[model samples]
Target chain A: MTDHRPDAGQPVTAVGEVRAGGSPDGGRLDYGGPWRRVSRKYVGVVVAESIVTGVVLAGISLFFALVIGAWFGWWMLGASVLVTVVLLVVAPRRARAIGFQLRDDDLLFRQGIMFFRIVAVPYGRMQLIDINRGPLARVLGLSDLKFVTAAASTGVSIPGLPAAEADKLRDRLVALAESRRSGL
Target chain B: MSEAGGGGAQRPVAPAAVRRAVEQLTDGKWHRLHWASPLLKGGIAFIAILAFVLANLRERLVELVIGQTGGPAGPGGGGRGGGGGGDAGRTFNGDPISAIYETGFTGVAILIVIGVLLLAVALFAVAWRMHSFRIGADAVEVRSGVVFRHNRQARLDRIQGIHITRPLFARLFGAARIELNVAGQDAKVELSYLGSRQVDELRRELLRRASGVQRAEAAAAVVAATTRSSAPLSAAGTSAGVVGAAPAATTSSPAEQSREAGILNRRVQELLGPELDLDAAPPESVVKISPLRLIGSLVVSEFTLVLLLVVAALFFSTFVLHRYFILFLLLPSVLGSLGYYVRRFSKAARYSIAATSDGVRVGFGLLSTSNDTLPPGRIHAIEVTQPILWRPMGWWMIRINRAGHASGRGGSSAPHTLLLPVGRLADVEKVLALLLPGLAGADTQGLVMEGLVARGRAASGFSRAPRRAQWLRPFSWGRTGLARTDDAVLLRTGFFWRRLTVLPLARLQSVRVSQGPVRRMLDIAELHFNTIAGPVRAELGVIDRRAAVAVFTEVSAAAVEALRADGSHRWAS
Candidate 1:
């Protein structure tokens, strides 16, 4: 696979002629790309998961067909196809919406389309920020940045970001939140 | 309302002495809740064994019945085979009565004797365990346990409030169970086992003690006030110059006199609920119901049901009603009458605003009694609630909101006192004056009230969503958006029906951020604000994740500052 990122060159169309956001001026970028155009590092993992899930399901169906009957096997195959299609359609859109902007005093997140909402996470209350990349996300070249607070364990997550971006966000948020909490 | 502590070392502290304290424990007489743990396990075990025995012997039992009845069975069948009712005997053979008697009449008699003996013993133990209570001047002690004893002690100072309830049976016995809400404790101390005479005696003693404490505190406060005035006068002369003493004394005396007059005015004002019209009692026609007529109608209406029931029963039975039947119906009627008597409208049920050392003690109770000892310095915020029905009556319930020792909903329940249950607008203002001492000086009443009204109206605009969450519309209307302003966070949305709740950053407990599949699908995040006490839970309804997080960070810092300020007060004192 070829890497599209050219550190020294001009901004290019990311993937499939889809401009996630921003003009030639790089004014205010909006909308993330389809997760297929996901970071190259995670592509292998996603393909491996897909192949493993498909093979296991197919093996189970074939065994049942031989032991029981053909009707059950066909039904199992149909159900698996329907579920796979649904997940494939939803995953990219979910990945695309997950992004965060780190500001000096607070963190900003723009999410949702219909009832559009923006959350401002201030530094003082930002207890911790953790970066994690799962198997599917790794294949997609994506990672999640989580913001934890002292009030509860269920923290906020921003998904579909590049791994390096996630790490940088975590470092900055932790420092700012710590300084604010310490009254510095 | 008043409780006296017996401080003397020689005072007898025994189980009987703690009777008053136990009565104050809860709203009902203390009966040991049957130690059901052991009994429940025993019952389950007994049922299981019985089921197992029957299941295992099912085939054998059928064969035995067939043989006994001589129903075409083999060699064991000795009785008549062709008898018409022979099959009935097969089923009846397993009956417990026959099984015991088959051994001999002695076995059956022994079973009955054992049953009666166990019942008699159980009844005695129950009575013995429940009748015990200990009372003392400072605290009431209760020791109750059947096999293993547990003791509960309640202090007078920890008594937040009292509630007296007379269930039907207790009413006939002329008994009332006193329930005391102990501060910083889950176990409510109750004194239920007292008879009418004992309850009356205990109640009298508690009231006398409470009043004595108040009187002593009042006297001390008066001396303090006199001494404080002299010291201030001297201090002003020395600090500001002797020439300025005359002006200082003149201003101080008038201010003090006006304050004293205000207290007297408020005490009188409480006699008329919040909505009193000083101009005149609304024209007689407008008053709706006259006091005399209301009283007369209530009295005449009483006991009509009982009288009618008795007459109807006599007519139906042709005066041949069983003697026991009459006695049975009389018990409930008599008990109901006693409850009605105790709960009847009385002058004593009216409101009273007693002068206290720090502020004023306003006490009231219909059946559930409450006494609020509000010190102005400790007051946090004031709220006025107008129930839709009270609009016609022109009454508003004023509440004082404060922090610290807010017991009830675990650690989260905030402390609040309902100062005016039914009072006019002016009365609400007067309460506000005492609760928020600097309100008049700052002239912020109009601004604060207007701000609250505006906020209340704006709350209706908050978004509340539809029921079904579809795959297409990942973000439900239930989500609320918040904007972080400089001083406060602006929240707008109504979940379904409209209501608004606002909290200052200083009062926020913590901030929460959450993301789910639907949130990710819609490219939205959520931020939640947790408060110590309020109707809405902070996180669930929040829609604007980014704004919420920003607000969270800011409020977290502010909350820390407020806590520090609260801590500093201890040092200042």
Candidate 2:
């Protein structure tokens, strides 16, 4: 048999380089293919959510100020503003951190800049592949690909893929899962 | 609805199936348990409710006495018979004591309490009458329920094993509950409230049937073996000669007779209908935990360490903080941990593991003994762990994950999933031999220890995390590694309490490769092998990216090969 050992001593290759070397059509298996970023509009959703929360907190603070006292209200408002600013700064970085890759027999999902997590769901173990479009995602023409596996811990939710691509991915994954599972 | 009405011609077949099922449930010497079985089963709940009611009554009576003694002309006494209807007036007027007795509330409460007791007794009787179990030729059927009848049948072929459980009250009554662990679905057939003798015989009969022994043949074989053993050799020889003289006179062949005699000598089991002596030769004992060792294990556990920490903190507080307040706060937790340790590991005091024909049997418990049979190929994964403190003593704990109802963290306390609570390296080897018999004679012990608690890397054919990965793990990077065999992949990690997870190639559900920014900085990635949801979770963190990729490819390939070889998805049996 031919040796299939990976070159472990080699310098790590950049993800961008790996992606650039892969076929643009995304139809064939590209070993260590480039990571696919979620839709940029997801950052907008985050910003919108932050703004809503900020507004709610400001309203509550205003109510407390009118009904109770000014010191507590002003403190609450200041805290809300601080939180809103922090969220605005972090949202885009988090959105950029989300990425997924489809391999020959499994789907890989990686998320989080800090407390990072990477999950892979084997095609054969895939019990359900669902496409969910929230109101914001629908407005942005994006959907989330949810892969449910036999192992609860291995479930993956890839958010912010274009609607058409999500549908195609779901169909392909369902078909692959069925064909692979049929062997068992 | 349309299908039901449209299939009218098939209606007769449905009823016939039902009739067959009913006959199967009630046929061939159905047995009822002792009359006190229900009382023993539901006694706890009944007593709890009765106690609550009596307490409330006592509190009311105490208040009445205090009020009457304090002042007869008090506000409550004067307004007694004032307003409301006849029942209310009777409740308020007359002597305060008489009024209290005449009140509808107390009367209604008493009546309702009595009524509930009566209903419970009646229902228990009905349930007792309705519940009857019978061992059939091919399956064991249990019929129960009064209104919407329930008839459950577990086919012998599909049964995984028979688990006998004796709760505290059941143990008091010398009764046990038998649960048939079936292969597919969550529907388990249970025959509860059986005498110990009956439980043993029924378990044996069911297991025999599960092994494809026909009931009639087993019964006849039992009879023939008993007679031969009881009779003199001369009589036996004459009977054998008579049988040989007329071959057609006996239904059993000579080969069968010889096999029966051999089985009788080996097993010597007595099958007297639904009751039998369990004194037959038991399965070979692999390990029996000593009480001292068990207590030692518990004392050296993480809980005990925390308890010790709190006690030390209490001592330090006397000098440093100069207040005993912290001790008060920590006392409850210390006591709680003590209680938890006692309750949890107390059942494991008498832990014993034995090897059966097709699987392993574990028996343990102090007050309520539990006997569980783990059939071959049911264990999805295994974990052999060594806490830091346990390493000095060379102690190991073996846990397994099987495909069934998920038992959360509480499952660790259960004896069924715990192959070994605490054992030496030799004991661990014995358990591994029983669990992974195919891997025996190989360097399994070396592989397990090297992958789990080894201080060095690369000595046991393991692929270790890179040196640079120490930034993430700090204390444990050198110890974390993965080892692969033809049948299993072992992943080991952790510094304080080391964990080694073994996932069978056939049971792997998925493989994940993940890298964070920090891991990317070190050129390493984490690999996770996901099996069915259970205790044994396998994840190799912070390995070289290339090695992760190789593992991902190799494990996926092995999984596919295993699928091709077996082509069966059921993980348990």
Candidate 1 global TM-score: 0.36
List, in order, the clash count of every candidate structure: 51, 1
Clashing residue pairs, backbone N/CA/C < 3 A, model 2:
B80-B92
Candidate 1 residue-wise lDDT, B304-339, digit = tens: 466567657755554565556655656577556656
* lDDT score for residue B184 of model 1: 37
List the TM-score for candidate 2's chain B.
Answer: 0.69
DockQ comparisons of all candidates to the true complex:
0.08, 0.19
lDDT of 2 by residue, B295-365 (tens): 88888877777778778888899678889888788778777767777776767868877644334678888
For model 2 chain B, the run of ten residues with the poorest summed lDDT: B1-10
Model 2, stretches more than 4 Å misplaced? A1-119, A128-131, A138-143, A160-184, B1-37, B46-118, B129-162, B180-190, B198-280, B315-329, B409-415, B438-446, B449-455, B567-573
Candidate 1's docking class is incorrect
lDDT at B444 for candidate 1? 35
